[model samples]
Target chain A: MTENGFDTSCGASSGTRILVIEDEDTITEFLKTGLKYEGYQVTIAKDGVTGVDCAREMEPDLIILDIMLPDKDGFEVCRRIRRRDSDVPILMLTAKKEISDKVKGLDVGADDYLTKPFSFEELLARIRALLRRSGRAVDSTELRVVDIVLNTETREVYKGGKKVSLTPTEFSLLELFMRHPRRVFTRETLLNRIWGYDYAGDTNIVDVHISHLRDKIGDKPPCLIRTHYGVGYAFYPGEGK
Target chain B: MWKKLSLRTRLTILYAGLLALLLTILGVTFFIDTRNLLIENTASHIRATAKPIIEHWLYGENLSSQAIEGTKKKPDSKYLKKISRQLARDLTSRNVVAIVLDKNGKVIANGKVLEEEPAPVSPNPFYYRRAFSGENEVTYILSTDNKNVLVLLIPLRSAPGSDHVLGVVQLSSPLTPVERILYRHGLTLAVGTLITLILGTALGLLLISSALSELRHMIATCQSITEGRMDQRVHLPQRSDEVGQLAQAFNRMVERLEASFSAQRRFVASAAHELRTPLTALRGSLEVLMRGAQDDPATVAHLCHGMYREVLRLSKLCEELLDLAKLEISENVQKEKVVLKEFVNEFEEQARVLSQEREISILEGPSVSLKADPNMLKQILFDLLQNALQHTGRNGRIALGWKLGDNGVDIWVEDNGHGILAEDLPHIFEPFYQGKKVSECGEHHKGSGLGLTLVKAMVEAHGGSIEVRSEVNRGTTFLIKLPFE
Candidate 1:
């Protein structure tokens, strides 16, 4: 793990192009600098009008849009880009946490949303998630954290080379955890992701399944999934252990 | 300044003063008319009675010898008595007394005097001269007995054509009937005025009280509001008169005030919650770092990044708060005629930067023109477009277009992004409304939540309206109708 708790081995695509649409110069400079440090070719648009033009001309692999802009807004930019290209993932950034804003961003063809004051890790994770959803990511089909390994194509799990059986829901939950190892995910996010968008089921279902999976996986030798205590849970690779 | 007085009190006093004035004028006119009529009738009655008596006494055979003796202008009591008795027998009028006077103004006969103060035989010199000239004259005498008296004096001639003047005949009548009529009329007038004034006052008070009932209700409602019952309303009557209109106006004022107060309270509560969320995150990250996570460079970076984000959120919140205040105080919108085509073209140039990595297209719908505050109108467009951009993804399409209608211009921002949930539609424009979609997307921070609220206020200030249409996973459209006027 690198200093940022990121798996340095799983590098982004060598030529991954990311477009940033932001009005604030300071934020634009920071994003450009930060994204480049993570091995992404970053381009910046100062306003909404220029951003749309850049999206058409540059055809970047991914785009980060800001809700507020000097001329046109991020939503318009997303829509305009979508009109030209239908495959690039869009990640929305806003200073507002309003659900309407999120829904609006998503409605305009954005793949994900990240609010301001976001951690770089979260931003990177969301970007990766969007890219993976779009099938543009270079991520591997098989996910591994320590001895626990999950195969996405075969829907199979292995613990110390021993086969482990899991329900479809449990399998998806494990997949999400293994993919974003050491990253905290709340029960709500897990429910939304694994249980589907209309899931009205109890959140305790996650707890119930997690405990059951822990018991079956042999918690005595190495604890794979760690509880964040009052927050959520994270899958630790157990390097310290 | 007169508002210090109660409505009922002021109305009653005004009505009473007007009624008193009317009654006084009526009373004075009636009294003067009655007095003149009574005095004229008394004078005519006395003159009529005295004419025949004087003629009979002067031409009758028995009074001729007495008249010849009266040529000597000496008093002849025995003959005057005989003449007076004959005159009295000839004329049988009541309340009238006759007196015969010698040419020298001495009383010769006194008959049927009604009062103890016998008729003044020494006539007034001026009237005596009038009688001596053979002209009859009447005078009014207010006697010592409080009786109004009418006196008539006529000269006695020998045979109706004799130049020599004999004694004068004086007739006096008491005016008791006329005075009685006047007294009765006066009593009736006084009683009538008193009754009218009393009835008028009672009716005026009743009317004033009824009319001011609405005012009372308004006062009660205000008191309730002051006591913190913000929902209190005054139930108004159905009439559309001034009082009714006043009630309606008052009710509207109270409703506005109540809404304002509640909005203020909500703003405070929401702002506190918004500020607290970020503060809590900052505190949590700091506590984690303090608990030795700083030893691991990766954990330290993670914690510091989170703390920094929280601080940024706090600062942004402060800026938005100030923005909201400024928006509220910006009373007037600088209005201008905005050519829709030109405006869109201008906006297109500026907005291209906003869609840096997203596809945004502008559709020229109509060459519509609108009179609006240029800056505010631009802001409206920006907010709606920004909202659309926030929801859309890469490869999603957003269209900005305008439609000219009879009433106004319809400017719209439509996007094929993830639409809003049904539950969040109504409260989308509410300040500080953190919808569930935000958390569903796993977003950690939110804006001051004043964006949509500010947009709605700005649009309304321009006398325009904004509406939204959305379907889950389909798209969202923000339609703003800005009127030309």
Candidate 2:
């Protein structure tokens, strides 16, 4: 096994190799068609044991593991893989939407989980985000929209080349808005992205932190983060007057 | 058979029947005694007047002419005759017969015989023979014609010097007058008894019908309330009685039931609201990842991490919800003798395996024994351990230990991690409550805030209690108490 496990570090050159460990032939075929259409080398495994063996031998770039398998469960397979490797980035496919199942997957070292009947667009975006985080893909590392620049690596921000002081929380909030420029994000979405999964607290915490971030970023003619009425905040520099 | 009749009807019938029976006995006894007394008095008066007249005739025989002249001139015969007529009238009035018979059984005179057949001989005919033997006798009978009669026979004797025997002077009077009066009395008694029975029956029916109508109304009202229209109330008549009190009690019960139902509904809605927010984010994130992972391996890796974190949050929320449901239902937790020491060791081993990537070590203490539901205990420990692992930074050590407590057993999960703030400690077991320090953790490590809540619920389900002692930025210890066998 490679350093990141399953040889997922080849970036876009080695034709994104994906291992589909699914019990259902129809879902496996469907996934194969979609991945193949996007220039991926797709391999299918009918059960957990084969999936694990195939993963070890082939060292695929990614593993799409179904939670229900004939010989072994997805949780056990994920734990077995994590026992020898740390950074393989395993994506779990589960038919159950129960929170206990999701927790089990993560607790066993699976990188992520997806309930069944998912859209293709969502699967692709997640893959891009994972690849980007691992530094194995060519993507825009620094988020830049007009005069604003965000260094994801150093967790720093600059407006018009002037250093802006921000709390760790504020810096992350600014980066989230900059990553998806011109898209509206509600308070709940911002909380989830910055504060992690299911962090139940005062929702006004978002508003409070947003104001603090604005103060540190300094006053500009058109605000850096614009609030959409009764919705959420958005990042757009030039268009809004 | 008695159970079939209502208590009220049965009691009324018994009371009225006993009263009528007593009255009938009293009336019969009184009528008999009064008729006997009247007959005895009439016979004594006749004997007193006739005795003196016969005595004077027998002793003054030599001067009988002078005596007769004296009686005529002074008119004593008219007075005597008037007195005799009165004695005859008295016998007729009381429906009794007066007879005067001589020693030879000859009748001297009769009192208004009224052409009726001579009174039938008394069943005690010896009483008439005794009167002829010079002793007075009174006898009672029903004559051949069905008339009730009383007979008083008196013997008349001459003066000592006279040798000729005076013939028996017998007075026989019809007893129909007294019989007629008694018959009228009996008729009156029957009519009175019938009227009393009729009145009692009518009153009893009226009272029972009224009571039954009220009871039916109450039953109908109760049925309506049971059918889910709890707003309905029993309207008891304005009386200070048992039925009114029952209505009051029923109303109070309905009030309590309505309050509890409404409270339950509110709790469910609030719980839904708490769960919806996390689920939506998790769904949105996973959707983005599923679309196109093949084209870019780097993007696939990043999205996988995001989805993993979301799943963790969702699972935590779900566990909290399950625990809440169990608590609400008061599920009976199965109990067995558990080796506490061994159980803690197993839990620590599991925790160590999970946190292997994080550089955390879970330490255990010596074994202890306690009686509890093994499954519920494990769940409580699992939740506590997860909370510890999440809050603990890398290289932080968590310890699982237990000791024999006075009441039962105390299991502790102490972690050298960022503990809860004082303000947040009180609300740690409330669903969806996160502390102030949550902003410190990155998006992936932050929790769903339901872990401790689930732990508390699971512990309580096992008939145990849990307490947390923590110092912010230092460490926290969760103490669980379970009963010992």
Candidate 3:
């Protein structure tokens, strides 16, 4: 594990190609520098027109598209890319902080969306989540963080080499956290990812499920699922090397 | 001073003055006519007495030849006394005096001879000469004593239808009695006119006040409005008079003013509330950063990122506020013929761009042309399309097109997407009012919340209307109808 949260022990160590279609020079530079530093190959396109062209030419494993572009917008670029390559993951970046933008981006075949002015860490986490969902980054169906293990195929959980049973929702919640360990997940995000996008129930359900999962898994003094007060929850492995 | 008087007062005065003028004219004519009748009666009575005396003297109806012959000549003093005694019986009427004049201009008889100690002086010599012209003479004179006098002179002939002049007879009567009667009647008429004038003024004042009450009520309403009670209205009467119509118009004007004021207040309140959201976010992010989050690179980056997002939201809000202001102030629409085919063509590229992953296409209708403010119409279409894109899922079918209707053209952007709730449909066009579900979301449906509001305003500005139909999870369709110009 590196500072950029790249686990070298993972099967695929390098050459995870990412295409970024962004009009802003600084953002393009930031994405390129950061993604490359995280041990992935990155390609950049300046406008929506060229973005669509490069997407077809590069056939990257993942795409980071800006919603606003000169010739065509990110939605258009995403739509064009999805037409030929339905399996490739697309993460939309929009300057607008509107859910409508996110919904539109996802409706147009984007895997997920991150609003502009996003932190590099969150951007990286979303990108990794998208790639993992597409089954391109995490080659194995199993995810491991320290002593905790989650098998996607078997839907099984293990703590300290012992089997731990989990409800479907708890399993999905744990699997989401294990997929992007050390990345923060707000209660809302967890609910949306685990329950469904249209869930209208109380957020306390998430807290209840989390505590239940922790108890069932038998976390030690330093709990695996760390609660970040005033924020959300994150799966933080121990600081020991 | 008259001009300073109120309308009611002026109207009353006008009515009273007109009545007084009519009454004065009537009274003057009646008084003059009655006075003339009275004076004529007095003159004719004096003449009637003189005729009998003159005929008796001229024809010597009951006198011997010596007496008749003496009366016929200038009437000697002894004979004049005899004639005077004969004429004295007819002089008993009020203010009557009588005299007899001979052909030789000598006084022969006086009707009031009984009262004279020295045979009453003969009448003036001019009376005998004026009366000897073969006809009778009558005159009215004001005597030296300020008495109105009627004088009658008769020229007597010995036989009827004879032109020969005979001795003249004279009669005089004072008109003081007739003058008194006329004065009494005139005084009564004057008093009556004055009473009528007073009553007329009172009635006029009543009428004027009642008529102007409506005006006064309107003024009171105006005062109330001036004091910021814009909802006040003038009390209206059932009669549709000028004042009643004015009251109704005034009420309508006040209603409009109140509605506009409320709208402006609502806009300000909504703007403040919307601004507070972004301001709170910015404050929270800065506070977190100041509380040592800056020491941690990841936390610093996240906080800065949130602050930047809040700033962008504030900027977008400002833009929307400016747009709303512009819409409010833009009173006139500049219209041009926009072909539906051409308009729909522009959306092709935009649709392709937005529909990249989704199956979005334009179903161009017939070549229908309509008048619209092109810029505003374009904005309206963009807003509707953006909304459709927001709800539709990947691979969902969305269509942008127009169809010719009976009256005009109907443009629509439809999608097989999550439709709006029934409760939110009515309020979607209100500024700062996001749908209930969107507002409750973890990541609020990012919007200035003025998109639908702008769309509605722009559509109306182009003299068009927008309508929506939707079913839960099935689809939503927005239709804009524009009349042909």
Candidate 4:
């Protein structure tokens, strides 16, 4: 997004919850930062016991699991989680290239597996694919919220029967807000959703995207996205003139 | 050439050959003795049959002498012929032929043997002339009839115990009956010997093969083991022979080989697993940094720090792997005399420096002397203490001491902290296995996960054993036993 040539909204990627269960601190941190940058909500659990509990509580769209955990292994955790929720997609991370390990992980209800040292791009692609395939993401071809119509497939927007031009980032940001109308999208959420959330710098970039999106959609005078000052941003459908 | 053959083949041949030789000698001895006994029985029967005939011939000779010339018998063929015919008729029987020869070695009467049984040729003049000198002679001759003859020459007297001119009574037995009996007996002896040899050899081969079967099974087991089935065993039934002893030794050797092979396999697996973790981290960090994370100063710093930590962990793993390999190559340790009390006192001081806030003390125990490398012992104690420090809280107490046991001294480390879970207690000593975290404050205390493994290897290298006992939420203790040297 924003000339990074990456779109966070494939269908609807914003606020897509993902849970990662891993014991390695560095790997877990790397996954958390990278997945967040790609605009997916990430929850981490350090051990299998906590991981199972979190999988039940988070009700995530996808689960990233590691096999080697301090208390219990990922297989045991996977089985326990699968017993409760059979629909959630589980992606396991393994350290061994042994076929038995991969087959066992799959046998225990893991949807897919990745070896360690995986590139973040591949991980993001896999997550997006899993989310789309699971039918968790909003997969409608077009969305209409208060006379603001967004075509997710053609990447076009129309306000009150008049087509409006928008950059890719502005288009993605609009698609996310329209997918879930009137839901609060924080600045961090906007930055994470639109600008790919790599830097923790000033979040004023989210404002710039919002203003640009508002301008392109013919909204003004405190309209479209309302600010929760000292917090983040949200889309308001009826309040926008 | 003999040595080139297999043991089974050589032993079979040797035992079979010995048995054959023994049976042949026995059969030959028995055959010869039986032939001699049969011949002697035939000769004695001829002598008994001739006894009454000789008496009858003497009575006829006395009557003839009384009727003609008044016992002045000399060179009278006609007078001797009638007496000879009478004597031949009485002595002739089955398998026995009688021939009466005059004093001049002429056969006077053949008892119809010449017509029916083909009598022996005329007696030898020198043999019968010697019989005329009152000597009874026995001889074997090949007669003209192509049969063997046993001849007993008896000189006829005018009366009992009288020295008078008479004729010679030759009691000749055709040895065809004895010869046929001997021939059949010889055939029996030969056939019996052959059968005995064949059966003995066969039985010997069977016995030898049965004895060697265990060895063959062991050989097959060896081949299977070479093919990577380390669990193959002979499993022979119990026996008290050499083969049984060898099987026992072979099974024991295989057990040791299997144990070592599995241990080696485990070591390689553990090394690969351990090395992969840090390497995975390093590669992941470098890859992240290379892919635009370097543009952010905070992310770059964080990734660089992580990479450094992983690099350090890799080097530590390398060092520990080297120690493990060295332990495998040379279990030979540099043993030195060490007094337990003094060693503990100095070691406790070093352990106290690892954590300044925790309570670590020593229990009073037996002051014993042992032969162990002090540096390795110190390293073992240091590793255990670090493990204890990582598991215990600030005010938790750890007691380290030694105690005299039945045959060895037991060194112990006990902590009054959160104990291990039952499931995890078994795998704590395994390399690269991380147990459940029990200490609230030990989160920052990092470990290589090879500490307990190294401690065990070092202790076992010194011919000692290490054992652990734990209960969840109560406490845990590690005991090491070093036998007195």
Candidate 5:
């Protein structure tokens, strides 16, 4: 899919397509707007019936399904999709606690499932992992911004030859900054790019995650990942420790 | 101890014991009657045999001359001794003992076929004294040999039918034949009573077992039900006996329990489903605002307002949930004296505000006064009218009416609009039940699905009932009956 003439976050087209089958209008709108911003072509089906029909026709790279629907449930839709295309990764969304476990018990072969009230960042991480596992995401594997090295494939971040642990949101924020080193991003852009419709009343989730990332990789004095005054953040590699 | 016994055992004992008592009483009476009859027959037979001997031989001898000749002519004792031995010898074949007493109350002679020792006749026995008075004396004694002996005395007359001062003749006959008959009769009575008791006991056990077999089957069915087989039934074929009725009642109880339990389970599932949708919307709208929409005032305002609506819906659902919990625990209804016309007038004021574009009217009725909880009654009207407004088209005609009935006051709400589907009418009051498709009803028409459920609960809490009538595309009506205290 890299044949497209658009530059994605992966430095090429990386034209990955995703299908979201959900009955809720608000959720569908949120997912569509955020996913399009992430450089992924998104298709929305308002119900399980149309979703099954779309799966047969378009053959998307990944499928995000909601467990409860008007005509058919998420499990039935997953089974119908798997009947034709077995390898397409399906991530189910369940509103109920018991039905989340039933995603596997029903043996519909869902690749993974997310309970409702999940943050958009977690959803994005799961989607990327599924796309990468299915060999649909052609993005670069390893990144190096000066002395720090990060592997997107293994999800390992190393600073000065020492392993550094990061939360999924922190890792995504770091990946975006390192991908475009020396370029600044605004708070809004940072929030939208990494968090992707992640809900919070605080409005400073990005700053919190950034500081935590800085702390873990020993960039607490803010020299490596530098912040511009009214802008957002940029990766400036140095012996800031 | 009797109370501790099984029903079958008690019934059998009562049945057999009664029979045994009746048979014993009948047996004793029959034995006494037959013994007396045998004794009377033996006495008559002895008198029949003795009369001829006393008149012919004993009377014609020495005692005949003393008749018409008075007491001064006491028959010679020497003459009495001669005839008495022959008289005793004459009765040897009759199993009789003979004795002769002279007019002076002296025993002159007594002989043969009697006790092993010559009989110990008193010198002046009561029979000898009764004989001197010219009266015949009769009595019975148990002989030394254990036989019944009847004693007979006759006044020896000078002529036929003559009362005279003459010597007396006495005869004692053993009653072995009557005793033999009595023994045979008693044996038959005893054996007959024993056989009847044995047969009655066996038959009583059979009847008792047959009568209680259905009850035993019921016990077995109850055990199976306790083991959680809700579908188990006694399966009796319309027997109208007590056990049959019990089985029917038991089956009905289990069915109701199973139905209500499944209803509870469905309510929980649908409650979770209903709650999730609003929460999802709230989350989605908030996320959209926090992510990027905050920069644009228009989008920020739109998302915030949408989030508010979602929050309202969630809070409304939570309130209904709490009301349902309260309905289960609160049996004490707040009592207030209410007049129907006044109550409806106050309700119609609220109803008009709620009707919006719909046409609302009130039907005039009697001012029926009753004791009830006012807030709960108001909530009932609130929910019912709200339900009606949601299902009806714009400008739909709505009517509220009341009737004072003999039992209670009936308040009804009728709406002329898109009525409930016939299939959904039965479940419309069930918790979280959706009457029609939400899409057809419009976005705002989507309900928390607990309105009618709450209405019904409140109605029941007032010691009242609610019923609904609907036609698919014509109209719907809900009737509430609040009984007078």
Candidate 6:
């Protein structure tokens, strides 16, 4: 009810609201500060019953719900929110980093998930991406890194104006890496980001997708994605410094 | 049957038999020689008694040829009878029977014709011839009565230049007394031999049985050991014999076996417990997540996520457990020449991908080579790398490098993050041990605690060893020494 809605500073448009349903005041405050920094208006609901009421009243552009709540759990809150608003994006926050919890969140209509003790930067990024996918924010049609370009809406990719064929998994991985170029991403982080939080495979799935991305991008001077030994994978436009 | 007897018993019996055989031979020889000596002695006595009488007559110490002619008249015959009677009495006491034979071989003066008539000798001319030749003779024969006897003959001689021949005076003595003495000697030899044989056999059996008993006990103990009662021991009589020494050696061998078995059991039980604890924790966590707080989507999701992470941990634990077990059971790891540079590169790449949240680097020279099991070496590197990543916080740097050592390759994995505590470093390789320093890394950083344990197992399985050096808050370095082919 306060003016300027929660402490967002990125100048989001009116009606671009984020509902934060968390019982823990510390986590709520943290999320409130981080999401506000990323310029999304956030509303706090201390418990599941209040969280459901806030979701119905505000019809939030995005819902950041905590799994452990006082009255009703986040799953029920998410399910009830889905009953009224099927198109709104929901991001679930859970203390337990379990696949079954992720599946339950997904079953109750959460669009994405972030585990507790997570970095604020990652949480903000996931929220923005989910919002963008749900048409809650101004749609950025194309994502680009140097000569490589990916159009998320059209599901098309191009390398220096040449059309490149990529599997869905490869496109998602490239999109993730391209969104945060020059940042090192481990296979586990890449898996969680591109393959959803519930993916339970060899983690070699990320390697295979990266290999496929490299193949589609073609073998040439200064590969876009560079491998860091004993670290992770990173995207570099030219020779890595 | 001989195999049933111990070696000691067999040897003793052989020795005793040989001794008894020798003694029996000596006894038989002595008995035979003594009997012959008795017979010879009786013959000499007969000849000695007859020789003097014959000599006196021949030398003219008694009546000559005129006396012999007068013997045909009654008065002269009476005088001759008195002299002959006196000579007969002396001869009779000397065990000699004498008779005077005429030129026609008729008995003339027979002395001592008692109740029993003397057995006649066959009139073989051999005796007469022997007498005429004036040679005293001795012989041994079975007479017509079938009695073993010795005979002696002496000739009667008249005075010198006298053309008359005197009747033959023969001294005869029965050889029965000589036979009696020989029989007595034979009896003594037989009894002595029998006593000697009995004593020898008894002593031999006593000595042999004592040795055999010891041997039998040893054989029984050996049989019991072979029957799988390894605890059974030989109770040897406390003798300083060879058998006693052998029993002591056998007992020492069994003691060694018992110690080995006990050690093996302890190892197996410890390994089982290490594997079971993690699985039970994982299972309990999953059960809690499954049945509790289903209505709260957020709580369910959180619990499910926890369960999932636990499952991941459990899976990792299972993998490490299996790896450790394989290393423990595999006596010899298959070896191959590995290009160390390529292997390290591959390991670095994999570790980087797994630890992408951190800054890790590989620093090593190009293309080192070593002979080892490629899989085991990789496993060791993997475990060390994983352990480093788990302990290192975000943005921390880990360095992996290797160098050639004198006898093998020395590889090191080091991290600049929070290092292990000095107190816990020693027991880091112990299964399920999470160092106090490492425990503070974070919940996710807490591994199954089997990484270093598996690393140690793999390293040792490949006949190599791992060393750890750490300073609290400084960093940790793990050095692996792998021998070259």
Question: Which model scores highest in TM-score?
Answer: 5
* Segments in model 3 whose C-alpha atoms lie over 4 Å from true places: A1-241, B1-184, B207-221, B236-239, B330-333, B347-371, B387-430, B434-446, B459-485
True contacts kept of each: 0.00, 0.05, 0.00, 0.29, 0.27, 0.00
Query: Which sections of candidate 6 miss by over 4 Å?
Result: A1-241, B1-26, B37-232, B240-242, B293-330, B333-485
Instruction: State each candidate's clash count.
Output: 57, 47, 7, 2, 0, 15
Per-candidate TM vs. native? 0.55, 0.37, 0.51, 0.71, 0.73, 0.37
The prediction achieving the highest lDDT against the true structure is 4
lDDT of 5 by residue, B47-145 (tens): 677678766565554456544555543334454566767765564444656676677766666756545523433333666677667775455555655
Count backbone overlaps in model 1. 57
- In order, the first chain's TM-score in every candidate is 0.56, 0.53, 0.56, 0.60, 0.64, 0.54
Per residue, candidate 4 scores C-alpha lDDT tens digits across A38-93 of 45688999888889999888799999999988667889999999999999999999
DockQ of 4: 0.17
Residues B1-485, model 3: lDDT tens digits: 99999988888888888888898899899888888888777777667666666566545644455554434443343454466546654543446666666677666666664453222333655655767767665454545456556666676554555666556666666666777888888889889989988888888888788878878878887988999988788877587888778788888888999988987786776787667545644543443343224435775576567668777888989998998888889745788888878877885777678666878778878887888877778778778877877777766788888888768888888999878889888888888775645521122256777998889888887667889998778888999888887
What is candidate 3's lDDT per residue for A1-241, written digit by digit as tens?
Answer: 3343325324333668988887544455445545653567889987777777888888889988877665566777788888888888888877566678888888999988875455555676687677777878754666676766778779998877999999999898887666555667677666655776567889799899999988898765577788888667987664512
* lDDT for each residue of candidate 2 in B1-485, tens digit (9 for 90 to 100): 97788866776677677767877787778778766655555556645655555454333333354455545322133233323433433434233344444344533334545654444243244665665465545434436555545455544434343333343334444556656766787788778877876787678767766766677787898789779887787777686677667777877887888777765665564466445444534454443334223234665565455556556756766766776776668776778888866776677677777876554444444566766788878888777878888877777777777776777777788888878889988878876565645633432354555667667777877777889999887889999886675
lDDT of 5 by residue, A1-241 (tens): 2332112334212467789999777677667765654567889998778999998888899999998776667777888899999999999888777854664624888998877777766787788778768877755577666556788879999988999988888888888776554556668767666655444435477788888888887776658789887667777643442
- Docking tier of model 6: it is incorrect
The parts of candidate 2 lying over 4 Å away from their true place are A1-241, B1-96, B100-227, B230-275, B286-304, B312-332, B338-371, B377-485
Per-residue alpha-carbon lDDT of model 4 for B1-485, expressed as tens digits? 99999888899889878887888789888888987788778778778778877775566445555455555544354556767776787777755677887766777788655456546456777777778888754555545556677777777776667677588877776777888988898898888888888888788888888988877888899899899999998887888788989989888999998887887777687678777777767766655554335546798788778778888888988998888778768975789999998999998888888868888889969789898999999988888887877787878788898889768789999887788888888888877776665334537555767889889999998889999998866778999998876
True-vs-predicted CA distance for residue A49, candidate 6, Å: 43
lDDT of 6 by residue, B1-485 (tens): 99898676677677667866787788778777876777667667766775676455444335454355644322232333445544544555435555555444455566665646343333335665555455545354446565643445444444443334443445555667777776787788778777877787678778767767777887897898788787888787697777778778878988898766765565554555444433433433333322223323565465456556556755776787677677677746888989988888788778878998888787875456878888878877887877777677788788888888768888999987678877887888776665544445533354566678777877877678899998777788999988877
Residue A137 error for model 2, in Å? Answer: 36
Minimum summed lDDT over a 10-residue window in model 6 chain A is located at A1-10
Which numbered prediction scores highest in DockQ against the true structure? 5
DockQ of candidate 1 (2 decimals): 0.02
Which of 1 and 4 is the better model by lDDT? 4
